[model samples]
Target chain A: MRISVQLKDFDIGKELKLFNNGDTNIGAVVSFHGIVRNNSEKSLMHMDIEQYPGMTQKAISNYVEMAVERWSLYDALVIHRHGKLLLGDRIMMVATAARHRRDAFQSAEFLMDYLKSRAPFWKKEVTKDGYQWVKSVLDDESALERWR
Target chain B: MIKVLYFAWVRERIGVPYEIVETQSGTVMELVEELKQKEPRYEIAFSDLSAIKVAINQELCEFDTKLNGAIEIAFFPPMTGG
Candidate 1:
């Protein structure tokens, strides 16, 4: 398992190659990539992602541990970027490997859902109007209830 | 002294990222009340407790949680990561 919080852009193809590692028992590998959307009222100029440095890694690792246990996953990888990003840039990615497709897919979705609400990162959107902190959506909070 | 940290707009409203607070409060709620009385900025930033979340020693915790020799506490809005 791997969890990376960084400012530099990541290569998805390279990350996938490193995750596989010729493990024959891994039958399915599922990945999800979050991207910055250009949905601001005045068009998004950029986004500043702020994070609690010490807590971010620990929080994510806890979720990854849960995913591995609940889904019986073979391996998992999470890479989330901090600092500045423009619209359409890759924000983060999650990859899950399992013996079957079901576990891999479900674990990846679970990771995304938890990451959205539980992680310490906050986003400030900069648009033509000005800067504004993005508020947490009610839908995101409700999404966690299903897992409980 | 407890190291209190703020993030996102909480930091902006408080005008600082973190501060060292010395207080006699026994719980996080009492500590918050003490802070709210310090300045209007704190009052405004923490006006809605429902919108805020607390962490003690980098772990998510409840407002009623005890201080208990904790070295760090953080207050911030709900996370919007990923």
Candidate 2:
């Protein structure tokens, strides 16, 4: 149950190793990485992400706790980056481990879905044409609503 | 006293990030009405509650919840981040 909102990059291998260390009971581990896209229909060049310091952590923690309880996961990790990010930069990561693949896979999806819709981060797109704030997707919200 | 925060488009429209306000324990909707009466700026800021989302203690919350010992209140648009 590790959750972090950091400004630095994370090593997936290192994180997975830490989760798997001396744990023969752990059978499956699933991880997902979200990366910044190179383009948007709005001609976006880059994105600036902003988050509330104390609130952001609380939000993620709450979501992670729900994922753990609902899926019966062994362990989970959530790491999100902030500040100016360019195309191809890793924005966030979700890793889940459990004795069986079902729990690990479900937990990983749960974390990503919640992070996508529930987190308190804002993304402002910078484009060659101009800049604009990204709009919330109804589809994403609907995806997270299933777990709630 | 509770700290009220505005973010993103709400911050841009309201012209400030946060402010400290003194109010009796009230539901979030009641507080919004109280804030709307404080000044014209607040009136404009909270004119359209439909577009705003409320968070009490950082979790997404409803307006009918009481703010008895809540330390912070956040108002922002529907989240659009990943």
State each model's TM-score restricted to chain B. 0.97, 0.92
Q: Tens digits of per-residue lDDT for model 2 on B1-82?
A: 9999999888877788998989985799999999888778878878888778999988789889888789999998877666
lDDT score at residue A11, model 2, on the 0-100 scale: 87
Tell me the tens digit of each residue's lDDT in model 2 across A1-148: 8988988878888988897766777889899999998663736678888887888888899888888888777788899988888888989999888889989998898888888767888888898877777788889879977676
Worst 10 residues of 1 chain A by lDDT: A35-44
Which candidate leads the pack in DockQ? Answer: 1
TM-score of chain B of 1: 0.97
User: Chain A structural similarity (TM-score) per candidate?
Assistant: 0.97, 0.92
Please provide, for model 1 over A24-76, each residue's C-alpha lDDT reduced to its tens digit, 9 standing for 90 to 100: 99999999999999763758999999999989999999999999999999999
In order, what DockQ does each candidate have? Answer: 0.96, 0.76
Q: Backbone clashes per model, in order? A: 0, 0
lDDT of 1 by residue, B1-82 (tens): 9999999999999999999999899999999999999999999999999999999999999999999999999999999999
As a TM-score, model 2 comes out at: 0.92
Q: How well is candidate 2 docked (DockQ)?
A: 0.76
Supply the global lDDT for candidate 2: 0.84
Best by lDDT: 1
